[model samples]
Target: MDIKKGYIFPKPFWSSLIDVNIRGLQEECYEIRNNVPSKYKSNLGQNSYHSPNLLNLQNPPEILKLMKQITNCIQTIHQQSRRENVRLVDFWININGKGGSNVPHTHPGAKYSGVFYIKVPKEMKRGNLFFLRDYNETYLTSQENMGFFKQGYNLLPYDLPKIPVKPLEKLLIVFPSWSPHSVELNDTDEERISLSFNYILFR
Candidate 1:
């Protein structure tokens, strides 16, 4: 199957298992947040540095099990692609509260990146996942060659497309790593819990 650019893959086959473990981890992380003292919490902007205050799971036995399931899903896609191999470099969770958001940025040095939404409240007004349009080369070419009769060139200011927050229970979104993306701030009082991860494909 030829996956189109910016195509959001259907929910992976093993997502049910992933959802179960993610729910368990989310509950545990929530409890930890409530008990632990956090000196600073995220505000509405790009993350400057990863917080030690937040739980960072790299190779926990439970998380590893979850990662394996995710890896299997990614591998299934990789096999269909021209490339036949892939690797999961790392995975981590982000706990965003009201007003916390990430600025537009692309994953550095990875082939594919994605996020699995765990919790989304009903009151959030503006929080959504956004993907930047791939336009850098096209922009430069258009600027150099002023074409009056270009076939498909519709010149306009570019804006990233936003994926609205549906009932984000078990939604897993994957996109190219070079695709710049961001998360909008949660305007309401509730928190948004999500897991962001990346993988490197060996061609």
Candidate 2:
């Protein structure tokens, strides 16, 4: 049996855990939680500190340096010829505790969005990120027509309706702004801290 795989409109993204000062980033999160005045409560998460604009804010030198590196990494992943033109537009910090989770949402105006995981509980239940696949393909390949293909390994791997992504400390995940994604409930008592950011190209 010979089978050829071809991608029609495959969604592509990038993720990695780079070497950084995890402990220092964790400390910075705590400081933001304690000192930041703005608290974003619209979402279902436990608590979120929304910065006005990370690029405009007078953040610590260390934090700004890391953001620059993240932008470079994302540019490399996308294979853009003008690497210096890519920039991170904004970013915010999120702290999800027990029973907290984010609803499905997409970035509004940015070309790309990403999250950097600083702190994750040792025992995480449902706090992982899950990307929702486009419904057109799944709806067309319903049980009525694709029932027989589900028997064994007959169906291709790209037919799934959702994709779950695990989180790790020092990890960075970058994807298109239009991708719909949500977080599961934080079952563990400890807090899940992450820095979410958006990026755009100037040239």
Candidate 3:
């Protein structure tokens, strides 16, 4: 007799490429950060410098290309047809200085959201992206098997909860807007620059 036990859920997926023009992107990011008015600056969290309008920057072809690739990957995974329309509603850059970190939160009114790591220090001391699993059967099941089984992609450990994302250069991660995520404290002296955006689906 044969039987199968399974698991299913929408988890954040990411892709990376080492060839993207990082220096160019960084230059543009710096310019935007410097030129934007103080009214547009946000210090609500630990962000040292947040660009007012990332996608609105003039002649921002690199960012646009990255956004297109991200959306294409998202649509492809869901098997959405080429004709289905999806558009990015907003995007911004976050420059996290030392001691900067974000509290756990979810995007309230968007179908999909994501982040792209533009610049990360060579030797990162603390800054990292951590994702939390929402309370569900998986959480309960993982708890039950805490000490017995090891956590692998195939066999998950029940006790293991938050997953940390490696913020490598030119890495992009996409996920459902409702997923809860947070940033670890940036203990390093260098700044951590990244772009965050939200998307919506249209008929």
Candidate 4:
């Protein structure tokens, strides 16, 4: 008998190395955090500063340019018809200090969501981002507990409960808005700064 592999339903996440001024972006973000009053937050945790919707405020030039780059890339990737278009509906800043962590959550109402790492400390732990699988899917086929844990067996994504992602400067990650994700506590002394946004498809 012969057996092969078939990739069933796959959830994809796109990441790109964005070209922007990280230092300048950091200064701008800090200034905004100092002066601007936060109206909303991204992650619910302590020792973190979350900004409100930047779409409603005077965003820095670097942020605006970065947004243009992101939207342009999305347009190219999605390749929607002339009748359809995509727009950034909301955006914010996240600066996670030591001991900062967020509860698991998902973006609702919008279509796509993403985050850009502006700053990340060296030799960090508990600062990683984790994309998790749905809880209801924890049936008998659950990857968390499989008796077949033997030698010579390759571990695929289907056999993992969560995927870990290390944050790097200038890295941008885009994914479906409904994907549930969370951040671990920032155990390092340095801070972790990132910009998050959501996009919606419109006609």
Q: What's the distance in Å from true for residue 151, model 3? A: 13
- Count clashing residue pairs per candidate: 0, 0, 2, 0
lDDT of 4 by residue, 71-124 (tens): 987766566424457899998988888887777788999878888999898868
lDDT of 3 at 41: 38
Q: What is each predicted model's overall lDDT from 0 to 1? A: 0.60, 0.76, 0.73, 0.83
Model 4 pairs in collision: none
Better model by TM-score, 1 or 2?
2
Report the CA-based lDDT of candidate 1 relative to the real structure: 0.60
Which candidate has the highest lDDT of all? Answer: 4
Q: What C-alpha lDDT, on a 0 to 100 scale, does residue 72 get in candidate 3?
A: 74
Q: Write the residue-wise lDDT of candidate 1 on 74-186 in tens digits.
A: 78766764566888776656667666787778888987777777677777767787654445634544535544545786644332123343437567777677776778776
Give residue 164's error in model 2 in angstroms: 0.8
Per-model TM-score on C-alpha atoms: 0.64, 0.85, 0.77, 0.91
- Candidate 3 vs candidate 4: which has greater lDDT? 4
**What lDDT score is found at residue 90 in candidate 4?**
95
| lDDT, candidate 2, 1-203, per-residue tens | 89996778878778887788888878877776677665563347545444444567667655766787798788886566444456787888778777777777888888789888888999996788888765675566666656745356654547666688898998899989989888888888898887888888776
- TM-score of candidate 4 on Cα atoms, chains taken together: 0.91
Question: Using TM-score as the measure, which candidate wins?
Answer: 4
